[model samples]
Structures are given as C-alpha cells and as structure tokens.
Target: MLMYKVTKENGKTVYTPHFPPPLAALDGKTVELQGYMIPITSGFRHNTFMLSVLPIQQCMFCGQNGIPAMVEVILSDSKKEKMSERPVTIKGKTVLNRKERNRLEIWVTDAVIM
Candidate 1:
C-alpha cells in the first residue's frame, strides 16, 4: 500500500505519497489482486476496466474520497471473461504512476481475469 504526508512547500501545500521500498519494488512485476471491476465501456466483455477496492457504488469516484481506491486494468487479450457482479481476482504487471496527481495511481497491463 502507498502512504502519504502533507507539508507546506514554497508557501503551498503539497500532498506527497510515499511508496515503501517493497511496494516500489513491485513496479513492472507480475502481481495478483482481488477487487470488483468497474466497466470502462458498455459491454459484457472488456479489455480495459477499473478495479476498485469496493463495489462500484462505494468506490472513490462516487465521492470526495481521497486517492482513488482503484487501478486501471488492460487485459492481456481481447477475449476477456464476461464481467461479473462479484469480486474477481486479476493478475498482471503492475505500473505505478505517482508523477502526476491527476493520473491513475496504478495501472495493470497484460492482465488476465483469474
């Protein structure tokens, strides 16, 4: 998990995220995570989607929740399984994006539903 600290810099407040050595070491490594999928497109099959820590109704996007509790997913193949209402496990190479505050915190590529 990522940690954060708030501090004032150059007369401006800044939010800084701290990635522990272990977590930072996961970049580009294959990892498996379980979460609910939030469809990015309107279809039963999708190559890309958002994996949320909670159900879609309770996801960060639904409110002013800090740091999105979601990761962008890109399926390894176009032949992904049909979306399910329940939580699912997925495996893929992890990519951490902390440079931009507006960008996704994590991105999973070459992903497969497990």
Candidate 2:
C-alpha cells in the first residue's frame, strides 16, 4: 500500500497509492511485519509508534527519495515496549487508508511485539 506515484495536481503535490491485489487482500487480516520502530512519544516505552521499512537512522518521512513504506502502529492496550533502534516484529491487523485526507497510507492496529 505504500507504493505511490507522485504527481502534480492543481499545482499541489499529490501521492497516489497503488495497492496490489495481494496487499489489498491482507486488509482486515492479522499480519506480521518486521521493521524498525520509530517512537512518537518521548517516554522509555511506547504504545503508539511508526514502523518503517528503512532503518531509524534514515529519514522515513522526509528526504528527496520521498516517504518510505511505513505504518502507524497502535499496540494493544496490554503491550507497551521500550523504544529500540533495532528491528522488531509486530503482529496486528492490517488497515489500509482509503481516505485521501489521511497522512499515512497504512496502519497496524492492536499490535503486539512478537
């Protein structure tokens, strides 16, 4: 779902997502993903964070290369793990953002570290 084609629309930048059938099919299903955890909060542990295909050292949401594949992960109420630059595996339900108003294209709800 992160696959996008950038174009100019009405003199503004637009990113159109291209979801393959296989990826689209995964929606609403529990999927396991492995990526680097990017914390949004400043605490030692986090329940909400972003998982990126690229390492935390790299810019996941900025740079000339454009936004990398990332998912806003909302960990389950029972799970709150410490932040780590190393890659982590999470299991959760995949949700695709169909609304253009949303800033991110994918999300992992009810996630838990595996």
Candidate 3:
C-alpha cells in the first residue's frame, strides 16, 4: 500500500508517495511476481508492459483496484515470445518511481517471463 504526506519545502507544497518500509526495502532487488499482462502497445510480444494484479476489466485504471496492484514491466528481451493471456510469473529488479506523478509507481527492469 501507499501513503502520502504533505510538506512545505522552499515555500512550495509537495505531495509525495510513501510506501511501507518493507515494500520500500524491496527496491533494487530481484523479485518474482505473478499477474496478468496489460500491453502498453498494440502487440503481444512487447518489451514494455503493465502487469496487473487483476484482469484488464478490473485493473486499477478502471477504478476497481489500488495503485499497488499494478506495475510497469520492462522485459529483458525485446523480441521475446508473445505473451499469453493467462497469468505469468516474472522476475526482475524492482524499481520504485515515486517522483513521477504521471506514471505507474512500480517498475520491473530486465524482466523475464517465467
């Protein structure tokens, strides 16, 4: 889950996303997660995509889930085999992108479908 705290710095108000200490500790570590892939592009063999805890119909963007339920996935092989609709297990190094307000909060780099 994510938490937010507002603070005034340099005479400007800033809103930041805060993860639980345990979740934040996972940053930069290799981890495995299971989810359904949501393609960011038009094809099935995508290097970059979104992994959702729920199916597309119940994704966070649809107002059915929270931000923690999705992650941005970047495959290690850009030309890897096309992904299936079924849930898949992926392994990669985790990245937390808290500063980017307009993007997915979590990212997995060098991901491989397992």
Candidate 4:
C-alpha cells in the first residue's frame, strides 16, 4: 500500500514515492517506515536483510533524483527476529527531510532491535 513506483523518463529515471507528507511535528525529525525488508544489492543482502524506505522506487542507486528518504537495512543482529520479505509494518523516526534536499536522496535511521 505504501509502495512507491519507479519509472523511466527522458533517458533519466523518475522516483516518485507516496509517503506521509511533511507535518509540523515531523519537521526536522525522523520517523519510522515499516515494510518488507528488501535488499537492493545482491551480494550484500541475502538471508540477513531488512530495508528502510518510503517506497520501493526510492532506491538511491537507480533513482534519478537523490531523494534522501530511502534507506537500506543490513540486519546485523539475529536475522531470525526480522521476518517477512513480502510486506510488514514497521515504525521508525523520520530521518530524511525532502525540503532540505535540492534533489532526491535516500535517508535512513537505525531501527531498534527489540
């Protein structure tokens, strides 16, 4: 439901993710995005995985604009605790500010291993 779509445009890639637009309380702050942890990078992400993102299209590698709202998760702790590659709900503080960036970039904050 919270997935963002990535498409190609004018020889450049376009990354438009639907996220909770900036709010007064969330300004200059970090919030949590809960979804199925995916590894965009192959060798780096395998069994041990988790991905922090505003949407699927918010990839730092392929995204034409450096939207700072996307973050990759490398689950270092017990991978067993992290589950579901499909789609799961997670909550974390918002670390990336769209207004702060001149362009798009991925932004992420570490999740609490509870």
lDDT of 1 at 50: 90
lDDT of 1 by residue, 1-114 (tens): 788778899999987777789989999999999999998878888888899888877766677456457888889866576777799999999998877776567889999888
Write candidate 2's Cα lDDT for 1-114 as tens digits.
Answer: 347778898999988877789889988999999999887768888888889888767764445355567888999985788998889999999998876655567888999899
**Model 1 pairs whose backbones collide:** none
* Candidate structures ordered by TM-score, highest first: 3, 2, 1, 4
Each prediction's TM-score against the native?
0.73, 0.78, 0.78, 0.35
Per-residue lDDT of candidate 4, residues 21-108 (tens digit): 5443453455555654555445532433435443445545556556434344433343434343455544444344333323323344
RMSD in order of candidates? 3.3, 2.8, 3.2, 8.8
Scored by CA lDDT, what does every candidate get?
A: 0.84, 0.83, 0.84, 0.45
Model 2 lDDT at residue 51 = 92
Q: List candidate 3 segments past 4 Å from native.
A: 6-15, 60-68
Winner on TM-score between 2 and 4 is 2
Residue 16, model 1, lDDT? 76
- Clashing residue pairs in all predictions, respectively, total 0, 0, 0, 18
Model 4: residue 44 alpha-carbon error in angstroms: 6.9
